[model samples]
Target: MNTGKVTLLSAGPGDLDLLTIRAAKALAAADVVLLDDLANPGIVSLAPRARVIRVGKRGGCKSTPQAFIQRLMQRYASKGLHVVRVKGGDALLFGRAGEELAALRRAAIPVEIVNGISSGFAAAASLGVSLTHREHCQGVTFITAHLQDHGEPDWAALAATGTTLAIYMGMSRIESICAGLMTTLPASTAAAVVQWAGTADERRLVTTLGRLADEANAAGLGSPAVILVGNAIGEAEAFTVRGFGRAASEGLAHAA
Candidate 1:
């Protein structure tokens, strides 16, 4: 009997357009799809004949167990069903793809990974800036503010790297994250937040490290957001015009 395979397909933030052609083709051929919380719901249409299962894993909310999701994938694939695990953003980027991959491998199930744009990149695009601006930073660093131990990351050490910081699952502890980074980064260091990046409801806020938390709070920004820090964020076209000044900050509270 021919064994089925599992395809770990990245959904690319919340934009259907950002979904890669290969991902779409995989979806079309899928017999079962495990959809993630952050992926666009419209993608279900791509797999019209496939059974879609929502195994959402949003922070601060009830989530489907990882073990159960893995078991479902294994069970289906073992029955010669083409299982597609659809994840938001790049599956390899904090999407628990590593654990799923390991589980599939141990089960001897054939697997393939289809890469897609991450939310960090979408956030950068929303701000119209390059994360690795030659004059500003050497490269980019993607880190999650949420750790398995619920402990904090070495913000000071990360700051010392001099790379653009793209922080995920950070809005809930924006203040502390900023405070940790402030140990090495100056208060005037540019910071920005992009909520629901790559979607129609996307909102952007540009400010300094000192004001990021407060500004984000004032703007009613919450989770499902990406926090960006470094000189590169200052290069955004709207940075100077929408940030810095008290008047502009006040306006941004309502506008952004």
Candidate 2:
């Protein structure tokens, strides 16, 4: 008997509109779905016939263990039931997808990955700014603030050299990230926090490297945010004519 396969789908943050048709179909056809908190539960509602399980891992909060989630995915797929692992944002970006992929590969379970709109790009889009402005910057690099030990990101490379930095899952360590970026980035560099990008509640706080930490913290931005640092983000003010980044200038945008 052939066991069912597992689809590792990127749910693209909290917005259901960002989901791809392939992912939507997988969810609808799934017999079992493992969902993370970042994903809108309404997306799972499409797969009403499937058993839904929550295995979310929120920062500083008690939640399901990673190992347990991996085991459950394997177990359910082994039973010949289509398993869908719905994660918020692009699963490959800071989502620990490599670990899960390895476990499934070792277990001989077929695994397919579906990419979604990443929070970094979405945040940039929401701000109506270009992360890779040819005049200000030519390269856009994505990096996590830390692994687990709170060690610094690859500051020496991206910062020392020239590249736009789009940090993911860095809200919890905005202070640390700010300090590190200051080491190489100019103090006057433009920076911003796009909280809950791609949603109606999207909020954007544009400031400089010298005050990004204070501004983002004071605004009380929460997790699931993306921080864009570099001169490329400087264009946010001009982009707001299209209603993009209106939150910063209009005051209607609260810290989401």
Candidate 3:
């Protein structure tokens, strides 16, 4: 029996519309889909013929083990099934695609990758700001706050880069992240947080580094959010302090 292939599909940032054409096609032909916690559950509509498996991986919450997910993919593909491992945001950006790719290769299963919009870009879009503006930032850097070894990245070095910093999975350590970067960057440096970017339930907080933690906490922004810090953030349309609690609309404060 011939072994099947695996397609690591990017579901984009919780928005079904952000899903790429190629990704939709892959889903339409899927045999088994391993969905992530962040991906829109509505995406399963495209894969009507496939068996949808909720292999949710969420930070700071109960999640399906990476090894187990890999084993499931290997098992399904070994039986000649077209396995689609759906991930939120760009699959290559901190979605553990490397491990899945390596595992599939070891098992001799052909793999295909379909890219989609990352949350960093979506966050910037939500704020109507360019992460790498020629006048503001020389470039942009995408980094994860959480590391496999549980070590934090060099915040001072990153701050010195003079580029827009789009930090992922850092909401839980917003205070620490702000403190580390404040060591190099100014306390008044522009900072923003976009939660559930590109989705209807999206919320945003725009403030300075010194007040990011406090403002974000007061607004009740939580995990699965993108933390953006840098001078480029000052270029955002509404660079002034803003909050998004359970109910918030235009003009900063939470709605009464």
Q: Estimate each model's TM-score.
A: 0.94, 0.93, 0.93
lDDT at position 16, candidate 3: 87
lDDT for 191 in candidate 2 is: 88
- True lDDT of residue 200, candidate 3: 82
TM-score of 2: 0.93
**In model 2, which range of ten residues has the least summed lDDT?**
243-252
lDDT tens digits by residue: candidate 2, 179-206:
8778888789988888788876788888
lDDT of candidate 1 over 1-256, digit per residue (tens): 9579999999998879999999999999999999998999999999987999999988878999999999999999999999999999999999899999999999999999999999999988767689999999999999999999999899999999999999999999999999999999999998988888888777778889998999899889988989999999887745545654222333242223
User: Can you give the lDDT of residue 188 in candidate 1?
Assistant: 93
> Candidate 3 regions off by >4 Å?
1-3, 238-256
lDDT over C-alpha atoms for residue 73 of model 2:
95
